[model samples]
Target: MPDAPLTQVLAPDVSPRPSACPGLWRIVTARDGGICRIKLPGGVLLADQADAVADAAERFAGGVIEATNRGNLQVRGIGADHHGLLDALLAAGLGPREAAGDDVRNLMLSPLAGLDPLMLLDVRPLAAQLLRMLETTPRLHELSAKFAVQLDGGEGLAMLEHPHDLWLSAVRLEQRTWLAFGLAGCPAQQRALGAVPVEQGLALVRAVLERFLDLARPEQSRMRHLLDTCPADAFVAGLGLAIRRDAAVLAWRRPASRAKWLGVLPQRQGLALGVAPPLGRLTPAMLRGAARLAREAGDGSLRLSPWQSLLLPGFDSARAHEGLAELAALGLLCSAGQPLARLVACTGSRGCAKAQADTKADAVVLAGLLHQGGPGSVHLSGCPRSCAVAHVAPATLLARAPGRYDLYLRDARLPGFGVLRATDLTPEEAGALLDLPTEHLDD
Candidate 1:
C-alpha cells in the first residue's frame, strides 16, 4: 500500500520528476480549475461508484466531468476542496491499490475485453496480472505517468489507433495462441516486432520494462525516444526470450474493426449499449441518470471506451433498446448516425489558456452542418496539443483564431492531422468543402 496520504506524497516539489498530467494524487491547476484524473481498471466503473463520482463532481468541483480519450474519467473545474474530492473518490474504491501506483496503472484493454463476440482470447485475466505488477512493484512505479501498455484480445470493437508504450495483440499460430507485440506504436500502424508464446507474455513485459529503464536516459521518456538512438533489433536481442520473428508473425496485421461504438452492441452472451456525453463532457445529472439506468435495466457496471464514450455491458438484449432511450433522454449520443457522435473537441478557450478558439462550441456548430451529409468523424483542436483524440481523425479542424480554422484531411503519406486542405475557413465553409467527394478535396 502507499506509505501516506496521496495529498502529502504528491506535493509538486516532492516528485523527483513532476508530471503535468493530472492523477488521483496530483490535481493539476488549469484555466478552469484543478483537474483530478481517476483511472479505471479496464475502464470498468461500478454503478455505485458512478453515483459517487457524480456526487463528488457536484459537491467538491464545478460539476463538470470529462471522459478522457484514454478511457478514463477526470473531474474538471475542481475548487479548493481537493481533499474532500479525493476522499470521496477513494472511499468509492477508485484510487489505485497503492497511492504511488496511480500514475503507473495505465494498462488499456478493449472496452469489450471479455464480452466481445469476436475475440481470439479473453485478456481480462492477463490484464489483471499486468496491472497488479505495475502497481505493486515499486521499481515499476518509477515509470512515467504517461507510459502505457495495451493488451488486445483481437476484439471486433477494439480501438486500434491509439499508440502505446508497449502493445500486445493476440494471434494464432498453428492453432496455438501467441502474443505479437510492438513498441511505440499501435497494432494498426506497425507490424509486430516479435511474438512470444501466450504464457510467456508476462515475462516478456517485465524484461522489456526493465530493459527500458536501464537504457533510457532522462530525456527519453517514451519508447519512441529510446528507439531513435538504439536499434529495436538490439533491444530485442538482449531480452533473452525465444521470440518468433518468422514471416508468419511479421506479416500479420490486425483486421480493422468498422464496428460502431454507440448504440446496440452485440456481445458474446448478451448485449451492451454504447453512449457518449456531448463533446465528452458529462453533467452531474447525466452521470447519475446513467448510473440509475445501469442499476435498473442492465448490469450494475459501466465501461469507458477509448472513443470517449461509455458502455453498459451485460444488459438484457430485449431491454437494451429501452436502455438506449433512457440514455438518450439523459442527453447522451446513443447512435452511430448522430452527427455529434462523429465529432471530438478539446476544452478550448473556455478552460484551456493555450487555446485560441472555442473548439467545443465550434464542434457543435460543425456537427449541425455535417448533419445533412451523414456521419463523418472530425476532430476540432484549439492548439497543437490535440488533447481530445489520441488517434488522428479523418478530418481535422485546427483553430487559428476564435472562429477561423485550417482544415486537414487524413492522408497516409502526410503527418500531423494529415494533409492541409484549406487555410483559415469558417466551420460552414469547411462543411461545404467536406461535403464534396474525396476526389474533389485535392482540387
Candidate 2:
C-alpha cells in the first residue's frame, strides 16, 4: 500500500515528475480542454467503473471519451472542475493504489491474456505481481511516464507490433514453459536475448528493472536510448539472473496471429465479442450502453484492446451474437468490414494545436471513398507526430493542409512511414489512388 491516503495523494498540490503526458491527477491542457487519462490494470474495466467514467465525462467534461492506442481510456474536452472529476474516478477505484504509482503503471498485457485457447501460458498472475511491484516501489517511481513494459502470454490475440522498453514473451523449450525476453522491441520483430524459467519470471523482471535504474543516465529514459551506448548483450549480462542463451531460445520466434479484433472472437472456453468506437472516440451513451450490456450478457467487465477497441469476455456462446448486435446498435463498429473500423485518425486541428488539418472528419470522407475497394487499414495523422498509432499502418495519409495530405505506403526496405507515394492530395484523390490493387499502387 502507498504511504499516503488516496485523498492526500490526489491533492492538486502533490507535484509529480513534470511531464506532458496526462495522468489521473495530472490533467494536460489541450485545444479541446484538459485531458485526463485513466490507466486500467491489464485494460480491465468493471461494469461499475465504466459507469463511473461515463458519469464523470458527462458531469465534469464535454462527454468526449477516447480509447487510447495503449489499451487505456482518456476523457477529452474537459472543462474546469478537475478536482470533481478526479474524485469521482478515484472513488470508482480507477486511480492507482499509490498516486505516484499512476505514472509507472504501464504494463501491457494481451486482451486475451488468460482466455486464449492457443496461449502458451496464462500471464495474468505474473502480470499482477509486476504491476504491484511497480506501484509500491518508490525507487521505481523515477521511471518516466512514457516508459512501458509488455508481458506476452503467447496468446493468439496479442498485440505484437507495439515496441516496449522491456518485453517478456512466453516460449516453450524442452517441453517446459520459459519466458524469452528482449530489450527495446516487440516479440514480433526482435530476437530474444535469453530465456528464464517461468517460476523465476518475477525475479527476472525485478533484476532487469534494478539493473536499468543502476546503469541508465537521466537523459536515457527509455531502453532504446540506453542501448545506444551500452550494448544489449552487456546489459543482459549484468542482470545477475540465471538466463539460458541457448540456440533454441535465441532462435524461437513468436507465431503469427490471425486473430481479429472486431465481431465475435473465440476463447478457450466461451466466446468474447469485440467492438470499436469509430475513430477511437466514444460518447457517454456509447460507454454506458456497453457497461449495461456487460452487466447483463457478459461477465460484468470489459477488456480494452491495443487496437483501440473493447472486448466483452466470458459470454455464453449463444448470447455472444446477441451482445454483438446490441453493441453495434449502440453505434459501435462490430465488424472490420465497417469502413470506419479500417481507418484510424488522431485528434486533429479541432482538438490539437499542432495539427494542420481535421483528420477525424477527413477520415469519414476517406472511409466513404474506400468503402467499395476495401483497401487495407490506413492511418490519418494531423502531423508528423502520429499520436494515434504506435505501429505503422499499411498506408498512411499525413495531413498537409485543411483538406490535403501526403500519402505513404509501408515498405520493409524503408523507414519512417515507408515510401512517400503522393503529396498535397485531397482525401478523394488519396482514396482513388489507394483503391487500386496492391501491385498497381506499388508500381
Candidate 3:
C-alpha cells in the first residue's frame, strides 16, 4: 500500500491539456469505453500493484489490460467507475506523485535496467531522478503528453528502434562512461547529436526540456514538429550544455540488439523470465498469475518491456524452466519463435471508430497461417495511425475493410508503412503472400 493518503494523493491540481492520448487522470473515451493509462516508473510494477490493476479492471472496466509500446499499461473499456478504478490504483502506489505529473511521466528504460549482465552502467538512479523532476516540477507539466524521454544503460536486451523525443544512450569515452543523446529519434538508427558526461545526464535533460519549451509554440507539441522549423544544430546550441559533438560521438551507433524478449533472459546475478500476454492483452488471471510468480519464484516486482511483454526479474537460474512453464500455462508466449509472439496489432474497429477492420482478429488468423512458414515481425494497423508499434515492422497489413487489407513490406527508402505490395486482399491472401521467402517478396 502507498504511504500517501487517498484524499491527498488523488487531488493534485490536475489540469491536463487536451490530447487523444490517455493518462491516469485523463480517461479518454473510446469506442468500447473510457481508457485510463497507468505510466509505470521505469516500467516496474510490484506484485501487489499488479493485483490492484487486475482487480480494478475486473470491477471497473471490461477486464482488458493492454501493454503499451512505451512499457506502460492501460486499462481499456473502463465503465462509469473511473474514480473507483483510479482510487484502487492510487492505493497500490501506481499513480504519479501528483495528478499533474501523470502525463509528463513518459520515460522509457530497459526492462533489465539494473540486472542486465552486459550493461555499461546501472541507470536506475539517474532515471529515478529524472522521473522525480518531471513529477515535481510545475513548469514541466505544461509540456505535451506525447513528449517522451529514453534512458539507455547499454543493456543488451534494450529496445533500440523505438523513437523518443529525447534519447540518451551510455557510451564509453577514454575508459569513462558518457551519455550519447539524440533528438526526435532512436539510438539504433539515428546518429547522436552530441554527448555529455555520465554525471551531467540529469542536467542535460533539464536543459534540453527547458530549451524546447522556450522555443516551441502551442502548435509545436512534439520535438519533431519543432525540428521541422528549427535546425537540429540550432536546437542543440540553445541547450546551454557542454555537449561533445565530435567525430567519435557522431560516428557511434548503438549495437543492434539481437536478444529475444521471451524465454529465460540472462542477468548479472540471476535469471529473468520474459513472457508476453497474447496479442498484448492480458486477462485478470494472467496478470494475477504473473504477479504471483514474480513473488514466488523471482523478485517481488514485474518489469514491463517495450516489446509489449513482461519480465520477472531476479529469479534463480535453477527455476528458470519451471517459471517458463508457469508463464506458458498462463497463455503467455514464452518463446520469440512463436508465430503469435512476432505479430503486433492495434485496437481495430472493435475499439476505435477510425479502424476499417478488426485488426486483432485478423492477426490471430494470420498467426496460425504463418506458423509453419516462420514469418518475421508483422504489424496490423487498423488505420494509418499505426498505434501498436513505434518502429517500422518487417511486414505490415493495413486494414481497408472488415476482412480486407493492404499488404506492405518495409522499405527503408519508402515512408508510411513502407512500400505497399498489394491492396484489398483478405487475411488469407496476405498470409500466403507473407509466407513467401524474402527473395520472392522482393521480386
Candidate 4:
C-alpha cells in the first residue's frame, strides 16, 4: 500500500482516544521541545531514508535522533515547525500507508531476519504481511499505540527478553516449520500457549487480534490487562482456528541467545557491522556517517536493533574491520568493550521533568570508573520508570536525587528493577561498589 501524504494524516483530533506517545502525526510535547517517532517497517532504514532523517532533524528539530528500544527511530527536541518535519519525513516515505494506520504499525523482527545463518525461517515475508494487516485494517487502528507484536526467526542475535502483547517464534516440528506463540509475555520466559502451521501464521495473528478487540473493554488497552481477568487457555480456545497444543508444542522454549550485537556480527552470506550511538542518542552527523558507510561498503541499508544500536549488513568479511573503524571515527560505539557501550541511560533531568538526575552525563562519568570485570551491563535510570530499557539489566542505578542513586541487582526472584542493594549513593560511590568482584556483589 502507498503511504498517505502528510496533509491527509495530520488530523489527530478525529481519533476517539488520542495517544500521548509521539507518532508521525501526534507530536508529543516534552521538557525539551516536541518528539516525533518514525515507525520503521522491521527496523529497516535505507541509506536515503537515513539521510532524510538527518536532514529533517538538523532543519526542524534539535539534531538528536534516538534509537528506540522497539527497533525504531525518533527525532527529539523538535521545534515549532511540526508540519515541516512531518513533510520531510513523509516525502522520504516514512509515514504509514493510511492516516489512521500510523500508530498501529508495531511489529518487530530480528535485525538479521533474513541473513542469520542459524535462522530456521526467513520471517521478513510473513512480517510484511502482518504489518500490512495491522496498518490497512481500520478496526485494528483502535488498538493502543503501545500494543506490539514480535516475530522471531530464531536468529542467534535476536532480542528475546522484551515482552510483547503477542509473540511468535519459529520452531521445527515433525519435519515441518511451525510458529509457537504466547500472549502477553516474551519467548525467553513464557511458555508457548499454542502452535500454528507456518502457512496459517497470518490467520492466527488476525484471529488473536480480532478476538482481543471483541473481548476487551476500552480501559483494557494491553493484552496483559485483559488476561488478568480472562484465562489464557480460554482466550486461545476462542481463536476459532486449529492450534497445536500437544506436549511437543507446549514444552518448547526458545533457546537463550548469547550472540553480541556490537562489533562484527555473523551473517549467512557476508559479514555485518553493528554500531551503537552512546546512551542511545544519535547526532545528525553520526546518522549521516553511518548511512554513508552503508551505501559505500554495505547493502545500502541499516537495520536498527532492539538493543538501541544499528547494524550494517552485507559487508565483506575482510572490510568489516575497516567499516567498523569508519563508524568508530564518527563517534559511534563499534566495540562492546567500550565503557559507554556497556552502559544504558535515559534522558535525565535535562530532558525529562521526572528525572531526578542527569542520567546521561552520569552514565558517561560512571562508565569511565567502571572496571573491566564487573557486571557486563548496567542501566542508569533517572527515575523508576526505566523507560530506556525494556528488560532489566544485570545492574541498575535508580536515581533518588541529583547525582545520587539506589543500586539494584537483577534477581528473577524479585520484581521491579530486582533487589535493591544500596541507596542514596553518588556515582563515585556506586562505581566503587560496582567494581567489586561478582561474588561480593551477589552476596
Residue-wise lDDT of candidate 2 within 118-146, one digit each (tens)?
89999999999998999898988889899
TM-score of 4: 0.96
Candidate 4, which segments miss by more than 4 Å at Cα? 1-5, 12-16, 439-443
In model 4, the worst 10-residue window by lDDT is 8-17
C-alpha positional error of residue 411 in candidate 2 after TM-score superposition, expressed in Å: 1.4
lDDT of 1 by residue, 1-443 (tens): 76665554444223334899898877888999989899999999999999999999999899999999989999999999877788788879997635677888898889999999999999998888898889888888889999999999999999989999999999998999999999999998999999998899899999999999999999998999999998888999888889999999999999987777889999998899999998999998888888888888778999999999999988878788788888899899997677788788999999999988998888888887765436367889999989998888888889999989999888878878888889999988977776665652321
* TM-score of each prediction: 0.95, 0.96, 0.96, 0.96
- Cα lDDT of model 4 overall? 0.90
Candidate 1: what lDDT?
0.87
lDDT tens string, model 4, 1-443? 98774465555323335887888878887799888889999999999999999999999999999999989999999998776888788889987735588898899999999999999999999999998898889899889999999999999989998999999999999999999999999999999999999999999999999999999999999999999989999999999999999999999999988888989998999889999999999999999999998988899999999999999999867788888888999999987777788889998999889999999999988988976535577899999888899888888999999999999998888889888899999999988888776852431
Error of 1 at 7 (Å): 4.7
Candidate 3 weakest ten by summed lDDT: 6-15
* Greater-lDDT candidate between 1 and 4: 4
Clashing pairs in 4: none
**Residue 324 local lDDT, model 3:** 91
